[model samples]
Target: MNIVLTIDTNFAPQAAACIASVCENNKDVSSISFFILTTGIKEPAGKKLHTLVESYDRTLDIIDIGNIYQYFDSDFDTAGWSEIILARLLMARFLPVSVSRVLYLDGDTIVRRSLSPLWNTDLDSNLIGAVREPTASAERRKALHIADMRYFNSGVLLIDLDSWRSNSIEKTLLDYCRNHKAVLFASDQDAINGALATRIKELSPSYNYVNSFFYYPYSALVRMCRPAQYISRENYEAAIADPTIVHFLGEERPWRAGNTHQYRSDYAHYLSLTPFSNMPMEQGWETYFKAWRTFNTATKPFPMLRYRIITSLIPTFMRFRAAKRRRT
Candidate 1:
């Protein structure tokens, strides 16, 4: 299996733990290669990562791709979001052409089991395999141009490089971005969904069990995302109970001290085995003090209450709505 990832100096330690999870869990697979597209990562960080991967007798290649994202137009940038979105979308540019397929994992993901099944999935005519994103689907309807079209998170992508190159997926995405420009507020995600919605093969949610699944019940989450197609409640519960890949996104990231993420111990377990085990654990007091955070958690049992709170908090001046307005 060929695995690829992108990271910066700040994320080296977290990425190391992520890689460790992959290596440790997929030990059954005798042939696994790791390709890391990195930026601004210095000596000791690089050295430490190299040692960890090699200890498991796995191959590791760190490609230093510094500030190349600056070449992209300003349309892709949002105030707080990093340029890492640009780098991740350009993974095909950095990976070897000889590699027909590569599994792209974000630095925040942890592999929980053998990924042989996911790796062996048939892409057919599709350019990529990914799980559908649940949050903010209605807000992205205009960007995706189809109400029923699936919008996927780029956090965990199983890319078919052969199909990508043969069909010029990269060029298509770039052209779409250029055409839509600033309207593609979500940048990488919008570009992928807008350009290649029909060409994507939806993977089972088990593959990328996101942090949201930990808090919201399947029924409540379904009402929240209102996706065109979703898994059965039983499947959702099963996947949540034993997820294949644990993705820590938003503020519930396990690395922070005060985070109440359900799978935080899993992250700690992998990190303990990595070279960065000694990394400090801290979360801002402000994060803990947020009234909304406490309220959100408390209202998890009552979806209606949470929805009302969210809608009230969002400014009316913004185009983004907390939830889709119901049909009469």
Candidate 2:
């Protein structure tokens, strides 16, 4: 199986943990190859990763993408996004021509199960396989001009490189980004969905169980807002029970303190096995509070107003009781 990850220096430790989880869980896969795309990762960090992968008897390939953007020739605004985000867009150009299929995982994801089933999934005529974004509504899909409600989260992608190249997927993505720069929300993700709208096969939520799944109330609120875009309750519950891949999708990460995800301990378990085991966890109370405030304030206007009024009118103890009820 061919697995790819894109990261920079700051995310090297987490990426290593993600790889460790994959190696630990999928030991039965005899021919696992890992490809890392980065822009100038420190030699020490690279060596640590190399040693970790070697210990698992897996091949690690690091591709330097320091000057990759120079070849794009587009004026797309990539300010908020890392250059590494663009690496997946050009996977067809960079990966070996003989590699027809590759699984591209974000650095923030940890594999909890053997990927053999996902790797062997028949894509039929699809160019990529991905899970749908839980927060994306049908209204959001229409705004992006996507024909169907198939807007996928690009965190976990099973790509068909041959199909991508034959269909000019890369060129199409670049063109879309270049022409509609201001409209892009999640840059590479939006570009991919826009370009391969019809060629994407929806993968099960278990393959990419996002961070929101850890907090039931928040996840339910998101689903209630966009029932059509979200996965069914059965799939969500199954993924929560046993996820194939756990994705730390939002700003809160396992390495940071104040992150209360159920799988944060799982990430730490993998991290303890890496060379960066002694790395310090940063305090994130402010970050957590900010996220909480944003969540309370940023829903659709009607929901936001109702939430604020309900919270304000209810007694503090009663509100606490209500929250505890929601969690169960």
Candidate 3:
């Protein structure tokens, strides 16, 4: 299986944890190759990653994507996005032609099961296989002008390099980003979906369960309010029950202290198996407070504030109601 991850020095530790989880969970596989695309990662970090993967008898390929970024043009402000986020767009350029299929994973993800099934999936004529974004809605799709309303999250992708190259997917993605700077919401994700809208095959949500899945009633409430835009209840329930991959979306990482994700300990378990096991956890209460503040500000101020108050005052009962609401 060919697994690819794009990350820089800052996210090397998290990437290591992700790699560790993949190696640990898929030990039965005969050959697993990891391709790490980065602008520049320190030697020590590289060595640590090499050692970690070598310990599991897997091959690691580190490719520099610094020079490749120069060819692409985008007016969209990349404030929170990492430089390597765009690397997946150029997979066909960086990866070898002999590599027909590749599974691209973000650094903030942990593979909980063997990815062989995903790897072996037939893309047919599709350029990529990806999970539909959990939060994708009709309004958001309409805003992006995605006529198909199939906005897939580019975080975890199963790519058919042959189809991508044949259809010029790389250039298509770059050109889309270059032309539609104003419409690009999630950066590379928006570009990929826009360019290859009809060519993307929807994968099971279990393959790329986002952090929102762990937020309990909050995610359920969003689904209830926007049933047409959200993932179906059956798929949502299946993903929550047994996710193949858990993605730590946004800045609230499990490694950071005060993270409220239900799978924080699962991340820690994988972290412990890697070379950076002793890395210090985030301390200070300020981080937690900041996350709380961000949560309150995510939606309409009044409704979010009211929800916070209800959750705080009612607690257990409200949680039960939320779960019940999810079932119905």
**For this target, which candidate reaches the highest TM-score against the unseen true structure?**
1
Better of 1 and 2 by lDDT: 2
Q: Please provide, for model 2 over 130-228, each residue's C-alpha lDDT reduced to its tens digit, 9 standing for 90 to 100.
A: 987755545546667874556788999999888788888888988887776676756789888887788889898889988545543445545434534
**lDDT of candidates 1 onward, in order:** 0.77, 0.78, 0.78
Model 3 TM-score on a 0 to 1 scale: 0.83
List TM-score per model, in order: 0.89, 0.84, 0.83
Off by over 4 Å in 3: 74-76, 137-139, 216-232, 284-328
lDDT tens digits by residue: candidate 1, 1-328? 9988888778888898889999988888998899988776798999999999999999899987777656466544432345566676677788888889999998989999999999999988788999877654476565568567667878889998988888877788878877887566667777888888888898878888886666566776676566476767877777678889988876567787777677899999999999999999865744553663777769988875665555464444133321222221
Candidate ranking under lDDT, highest first, comes to 2, 3, 1
Order of the predicted models by TM-score, top scorer first: 1, 2, 3
Residue range 1-328, candidate 3, lDDT tens digits: 9999999887888999999999998999999999998889998999999999999999999998775548666344433455578888888898888888899999999989888888899887888899877455455466567744567889999998888888888888888888877656566888887778888888987898885455434454454234435556776677668898988875467877766666788899999999999988777745655756586457444554544553354435444544654575
- Per-candidate Cα RMSD to the true structure, in Å, reads 5.8, 8.2, 8.6
- Alpha-carbon error at 126 in model 1, in Å? 1.3
